[model samples]
Target: MRSWNIAGTLDVVPAAERPDLLAEPVAKALRELGADTEAGVVEIDPEVADTEQFCETYGSPLDASANCVVVAGKRGGEVRYAAAMVLATTRADVNNVIRRRLDVRKASFAPMADAVAQTAMAYGGITPIGLPDDWPVLLDTAVAEAPEVVIGSGTRNGKLLVTGELLASLPAAEVIDGLAKPII
Candidate 1:
């Protein structure tokens, strides 16, 4: 097992070993992926779960953190949803790339209530690990190439440490060249 520590601040343990630290769905997904999944989990203060605060408080590199956002679009009166993963230093291109990929007239971040309700995850901790099967998991190339990244654990009280390759292997995941744009 590799050391999953982040700047010597977070004590990351194998996610399979700390099932209690993950949301039920996340835990279940890890289990289903079998024992070789390269992922870890660490408990955290819910107050610092958001990307900026969590990175600052935990001494985690901002570039080594990933954010998962739920996006929604409507076409022909039907709603389509997807999860977009990008490094914390960038923002997902929901209006153009995502809109075109989703094949919707327009795409936007899903409302907090709708996102949480649909994913059964906490508002600030919607990881792509256990998203609905039909929802595409869009992975930014940068995120997929990162050696390691800190991401939400489906609950505000914890975070997951995983390799980009692990995320790229998730169900329905699609790696894209420019899924996000650097924040200016």
Candidate 2:
């Protein structure tokens, strides 16, 4: 397996070998990706699953971590949902870019209950992988170009380590140049 650029005390192993650490959807998705995939997973404390806490507790660099957020918009009584993947160092441009892409008058983070229910993933561990096929996945250019990134494993107890190229190639993924803005 190729070495990852991730730092800290993470002990990442092939994701396929640790199905127990992943949620069903995540595991199923990885399985569908084939056995030769380079994705890796590391067990983590569920308490620190949030980006900032996870980075601090696990010693992972903020820039090397990615966050997946679900956004929702409504038009003509129909709801549209999309997932955005961005680096921990930045934030998704939900109000502008995502709202425009979704072609809705307004866009905002989906309610936690709805997000968790629809994604069939834990709230603090929603990864872009295994999202509903109908939901567009917006990939921030920066996250898609990173050498390696730590993202949610569909469960708070683990995180997945993968190359940005892999994430960009996911189903329904659309790489956007400025999908995220650096936090100031």
Best by lDDT: 2
Clashing pairs in 1: none
- In model 2, the Cα lDDT at residue 158 comes to 92
- Taking every candidate in turn, the Cα RMSD to the unseen true structure, in Å, is 1.3, 1.2
Flag regions of model 2 displaced more than 4 Å.
Answer: 35-37
Model 2 score (lDDT): 0.90
lDDT per residue, candidate 2, 1-184, as tens digits?
6666674787878888888778888888878876325798889989988999988987889899999999999999999999999999999999999999999999999999999999999999999888899999999999899989999999999999988899998888999999999999
Model 1, 106-177: lDDT tens digits are: 999999999999998899999999888999999999999988889888999989998899899997999999
> What TM-score does structure 2 among the candidates reach?
0.96
User: lDDT of all the models against the reference?
Assistant: 0.89, 0.90
Q: How far off is residue 156 in model 2, in Å? A: 0.2
